[model samples]
Target: MKPVRFQFKLKYLAILALAALLLGNRGFRSLVRNYREYSRLKSEKAQLEQQRVDLEKKLAEISKKPAIEQAARTELGLIRPDETEYRFPAPKESDK
Candidate 1:
């Protein structure tokens, strides 16, 4: 009778230990997932910072008067003072 009672207690303790181990394992997996997401967001933030710096440098360059004038002339086809301006009339549509 004594040996049977001891065996029952041992089996109960083993079951409790297994449940605790499984809970701990699940907690460890969740921690790993959170850490990976944190690292990915940090790297993306660094990339965005680099892009911002590059844009700021370009903005500084384009703030110059000469650069602004050159861009306007090339993009808008604008002319300086003393330059001749040509205007072409729109062609009329022919009767169908």
Candidate 2:
């Protein structure tokens, strides 16, 4: 009777240990997943910050007189005071 009681206690302890191990493993996997997401977000934040800096520099440059004039001339097709504007016709497909 004592031997049977010992065996029952041992079995219960084994099951409890296995449950604890499974819970710990799940918690560890969750920690690893969170860490990987943190690393990805950190890298993305750096990239976005660099982009913001570049855009700010571009905005500063475009706010100036020369960059604004150049943008106007090229993008908006605004000519200088003494210049004559010319528009050429599109070529046919055979021209290619």
lDDT at 89 for candidate 1? Answer: 77
Off by over 4 Å in 1: 1-24, 85-96
Residue 67 displacement in candidate 1 (angstroms) = 1.0
* Tens digit per residue, CA lDDT, model 1, 1-96: 579989999999999898887777878778889999999999999999999999999999999999999998889999989999888877768732
In model 2, what lDDT does residue 18 have?
A: 90
The lDDT of each candidate is 0.91, 0.95
Q: Please provide TM-scores, in order, for all candidate models, with all chains considered together.
A: 0.56, 0.63
Query: For residue 33, what is the lDDT in candidate 2?
Result: 92
Candidate 2 residue spans exceeding 4 A from truth: 1-24, 80-82, 88-96
**lDDT, candidate 2, residue 79?**
91
**TM-score of model 2 vs. true structure:** 0.63
